[model samples]
Target: MRKKRIIKPLMTRLFREPHFEEMTNEDEMDLKKQDISRSYHQNLETFKSIYSIPKNTDIKLREFTVRSLNRRAFIIYIGTMVDIKNIQEGIVEKLIQSQQPSSKIQDIVSYPIEKTASNIGDIIGFINGGITALFVDGDSTCYLFETTKTRGRSIEKSINEVLVKGAKEAFNEKVIDNIALIRKKIKNENLIVESQTITKRSKNDIFLVYQKDLVNNELLQEVKDRLDSIDSDKVLELSILEQYLEERPKSLFPTILYTERPDRAAAFIEEGHVVLLMPNSPSCLVLPATFWALMHSPEDHYMRVPYGNFIRLLRFLAVFVAAFTSAIYIAITNYHVGMIPPDLLMAIAGTRERVPFPSIVEILMMELAFELIREAGLRVPSPIGPTIGIVGALILGQAAVQANIISPIVIIVIAVSGLSSFIIADVSMNFAIRLTRFLFIFSAGFLGIYGASALFIVGLFYLVSLKSFGTPYFAPMTPYNFSAKDLLIRHVPIKEKLRPGYLKPKDMVRQRKG
Candidate 1:
């Protein structure tokens, strides 16, 4: 039996109206934590108690003077980020040079960030912004001297979301800068940035940005609930955090879309989907992303409807060509010889008659060569990279065909397949295309076009069956959305008024009804 020991006299001495036990327990926990943290520092108990920095770094910031705050106070901040000059000119100079004010450390001193930074959390943020931290001999609280130097990548076209013509500005590493860019575009008070600090890294800043009135409250609440539930040790970037947070990260198709362009992210917010902005990460994530969403690009809006639709449709065709080109060639050559045109068939036969490998083996060999060239080109420096890829592919591909190790037809097919693979902006989709292309080849080899067709149908079914954040992976197309204008054809922007029903998102209406 558990004994209930009541502290009757102890409760009365502690000046509290009620709930003395709970308060005592909480205080004990806090003291215990402080003791444990202090003990971890060993000889450096004074410095470690304040910042709680791990014991590994061995360097105790030799630049600054460390005085025991027996006088028990110490301040810590990254050296490069903190403005030493500002600290000397503003905080330390002002404090030490002046006639002493009230003895209590709580004297409301006049400082820029200090007004909001009495606590350790606020001060830490202030220092991270390049402000220096100031330590008084004995005070428990630390003051961050604002001295963060201007440092970050200039806003430019993001490497991933490269656009021929769209907003030139892409998100830089700074969270505030990125948000400011978007806020400048919308200029609405209703735009809400619901911030969260994940338990993983207490310092990580996450913003769930959406148009307040436009976004349903329930949706916002759900976003908050899920964010609260996320528990991890450390989150360095938004992509890593997203994998853990999203409903179907294991799925091959990406349900969450991240773009460096604020214009695109802002548009998603306007349509009432949640956009998560993470600190130290330039790319912002859009939830409930669909397959068609990956296919669409920001330039789709910049160009006139007909041109946009034509380009999008072209992209759709390009995907098929990339995926099925080699497979179809292998199938037709090895299994369905009758399907090939008579003249072309004769030409292919003449070319391959000299080659010894089976059509499948030849196709796979060429594809592997192309992939190797592509990968090597990407891995090296950009200046030499593209040149190496072009020279390497041209030389190797030509030499392979001449040597009779691979057929000329296989060379052309592999080249086209590799070229088409790069057309899709999303790398993951490219991988999917690359994988499916080989499947198509095997299908054609085994059962010709019939097998290829059946495999494609089955693959498409799995694609449609997949969901991103509970939204249909192939909506408006698979379910046959009546408003196919935006999905396949780009009607004049005005005609494509309503938002896509793919997400069945909280806000359905897009453009204001006339």
Candidate 2:
């Protein structure tokens, strides 16, 4: 009977369903949902349990007596996230040495009280955000102090969006600094910076920056609705939040433009576009991005009108060259050889005499090689990366040509195509153009110029139908809205005075007619 009883208990213990985890989660949730208790001991015990005291070494719970009010109190904060000097000198020392007998808790602390909260959940949030929460004996409300010591890099020059003549400062990983940078540019009362906690567990804050008087109500509400609808436990950065906010997640072309330049973001905000900024992301996302906006550079507006227009024209041509150079080469050589001049045609034929592969195959091999070199250069260490790229391309191209693996003209075609892609400023647009180039190459190989043209028309149709937060992708040009004629070439600042009409901004005129 003893043996049987022991075996039965052992079997039950071994095969029992695991509910401890579920039960623990439920209890934690209940604790988080509870309000702060009037009894200081109860609050202290609750916080200790929630933070797993003794086990969680980084969470500091310092208990002290406020001599002024003759009340016992404790402050809870994450040790690594807060400043120890401020807590010791400003909060604890000031409260202990105060002589005001009837003074409130806020009066005793030397640090300014940021806010007060009664719910356990809010206090936890405050603690997590690097804020110090003070719970007093008789007071139910917990006082919060701003003692966050977030570490981030100082403002540095823009790396990706380098400009010869513009604001050189780029945003760092701090959202508060980014907002200050924008505020420095625009000192208007109407400029608004509204924040919303998007995630449930992480409580990541996303800032919506816009000119309140100029921004469309419907557009702002739409952005808010999308942000509020995010059902994730954590959305840590603007890059991740961008995926959640975009209308079409699978679309090849990016609807929003991401820029690290605070000046660029500020310019967009002044023009009635909404900018999304989040902590840890060194860039801000500009919404309702049009093709023109993606293609434009800050240097365009900084330079003289003629110079800006000249560069803009070159960039516009470069886009086509990058997307069509290799594809056109394949089409002409394989299917439209008759169009070539006799001398040129004979020269081309002579170069390819030793080449065994078809023109399509030859071009594909070169394109792939170029892409590999570019990606390798980006991924490798900065010091040796450029050297590797230059030497690798030189050696690889020379070897291929000498061995007659690829024709010499194939090298020229790939080089020009790759170089032209760099003129595009926006990373997402650069990727879109590069990927579409491959599609054109495939189409051209199959049906020559006709296939390429057909694909181009379909792409145009797609762009026309696409919308970023209700603004057309090809706005002010395709839809013929009344705005500055800045599509292919931007006019001088004096002449370009109206905000984009597609945004339907509350105020249409940027400057009054003189």
Candidate 3:
């Protein structure tokens, strides 16, 4: 027998596959090397093979004969997503009538052809929207004929963020559709959308929306840098993306603003903030957002200027009341009875006497009950949600007070606080209100309203210190940007000329009063 030669193998390490294409020239003898074109083709076929596009799918695949060109062509489209009559005139008629003068794709010139499309994916993209790609048999080049979908929802009032007066249309999940909506308002070249692939496996779409002139260059760089730093395998939702880009990840207050309304998003884009739109989510994020920005609704700008201002002022007051009402009630009854109105105090004390629980216990129980009802209303179906909100809150509060487990005074205070909390349009800010409520309640129990007042002062200082992309959270107050609040609190349309002072605003005035 011949002596066996034992060759110790090098490079034995094996690991997970990288999603990116690796350009390498190693020969087939080395199994570690890969061919990009071949690999891409394989991946395409594999993906196509595995995908179960339902038969109900309207996207049609038709192969037609081009007699003039004497070549066969394939048409991929969804009927509702395009104007069929245009296709007949612009594509089919031209293809059938025109004679082929050249064999090369580069030499053929008769009509506009979309060049951005490179492969099967590009073909799929055109099929889903305006522009249908015609792949001629034996020719690698494709013609993208314009045939964008038009039959869809007209701009209507948004159901969520229901503005008793603002623009109703919300941004839909479709990326291009959302982009068009924003374009309707900001008809400027400066408005830009920077595309990014959020998912490696599915290639989820993410757009960084901003007006180039107004947005902070440093903040914009930071946004891109954070996104680039992500080494994750997938990015399926907005919450995940927010955590990566946000400056303070663990903080209770939301550093980014999320909205479903297209107008709201468009307004933010014009105000020197950066908006991000996701592929399939209607709710996209607006970055470098201030604390005041969240409390506002587009209606605050849309309604009569005086009405809008009054509502804004009311909201400002409501926030303070909702955050401190219960604590004030606790402090007055338990510690500072002298500060309370004599008759009212006597009546409150009378109600408290029947309750088995102490003032703190009673208040906590009522607050917890209100939260439970709110949770139940949210989780339930929309049709019945309002009913639950009404029945659960009214019936449960009344029953609790009647049972004497919680006092009637507790019920009244909780009701006012809950309703007041809802006055602020943004959901993220309510967390602050909720947090402050508890702190105030505890402080009143421990050292009366004096402790609560001190806590409020600290809270104000903290809010002043917090920054979003270098723009102070309390604009016009802490950072003292006069140009900010005119638009922020809602103003006379003709007079409000300047943009918000934030995110390193490139322009202060959008229009000048002559």
Candidate 4:
């Protein structure tokens, strides 16, 4: 019979709270130098200790043998992270059924990603990435198989930036699936997708995707240098990386574009823009965003030239209304009242005869109420979101008007301005427009038309000064680049034979006469 040996006193003496001050530099170095042992048993024990295997129910370690080679082997993998079907059919079944003795590792696994891991760090990395590790009893090396099985939502229509015509599918949370979508769109050999590890602790994979031939060497080098300089321990999402990657982090306008649709990202890649793809993020980042790119939508490409131009014009007008309508109304009411027709002036005066507050105060109050309603609608569940907006707007506006707290005309102006803001497709740019609107409103309140006009001119100067990755933010408009066409106007598809000359692409001519 085996004897039970109790060493409670020994255990008490050996295990205790660590004292950091007592540890020497050499001891710290020794701790850091720990590596995988050559013996299979030692390596297995190390993994168990590291993962707390017996305590951790999710980690499964199965011991088996290659009967053909007469060697003992064990498979260590996370049950939830790996594909069970692949492990069963690809590894276990094949190994069990092979009658012929095989000494080569390639005979066992035909996985394109099969790799030999020598150290504990490599083994841990492979296991963490949802790969199964095969540790043989005699050999010092271990084999890794990519059996990752990540669950994600199926491709669905884009909730934001929706279109009546164009690709319906948006990017999901899976990075591999996103890359596959891009590859499917652009099958050219020059479409390069390079994987890079950003964070040391998490070892998050970030992909730099771009066309090798079309991408400018300087811009590519700059991107690489910036990525290389990131010294973060963990980057949880792509947006976090974006903040670090941005040239002017505090700028009001977004220097880089973010897109949820694969078609949009692929189109930008074809235009010589480098896209940064991060794991777990549904959106991809497009570098060096231009003013035109921000305003352009996928629907523009789907429609014919004239129709597209018409839509673009309407969108521009919507932006004008969103940003300047309230400000212009305030300016005209306060200082430029002469500009209004006598009939309209008499009607406005008659409506405001009941209200005691100034025009600016009433307008601001209604705008704030509208913003609150917008927030409440956005925060509620999908089915009830729109319902909340409609009910709240109707009740609140009616009540405020009945109480004479705000003028009916003020409500109309605020509602129209808020509605116009929704026409903007890009979320970041839309937010910028909203912020700029607030500035214009305040300016209009102070000095009427003069304040608003001065602020507008200053904003234009600031925009012209800003650059996105060495490309001017205003681009062809400010610098007067001749080769680039279709600014504020959409030309026929065939007429645009050259790429944007301001971008300085290697091959400018997109189409030749031949």
lDDT of 3 by residue, 24-43 (tens): 22311232222112232233
Q: Tell me, by lDDT, which candidate is best.
A: 2
**lDDT of candidate model 3 versus the reference:** 0.70
Q: Residue 72: error of model 2 in Å?
A: 1.0
Q: Is candidate 1 or candidate 3 better by lDDT?
A: 3
Instruction: List ranges where model 2 is wrong by over 4 Å.
Output: 1-23
Backbone collision count in every prediction? 9, 0, 6, 0
Model 4 root mean square deviation, Cα atoms = 5.4
Q: Tell me the lDDT of model 4 at 154.
A: 77
Encode model 2's per-residue lDDT on 298-354: one tens digit a residue: 999999999999999999999999999999999999999998999999999999999
Candidate 4: the clashing residue pairs are none
lDDT order, best first, reads 2, 4, 3, 1
Q: How large an RMSD does model 1 have? A: 7.5
Backbone clash total, candidate 1: 9
TM-score ranking, high to low: 2, 4, 1, 3
CA error at residue 236 for candidate 3, angstroms: 2.9
Worst 10 residues of 3 by lDDT: 1-10
lDDT of 2: 0.89
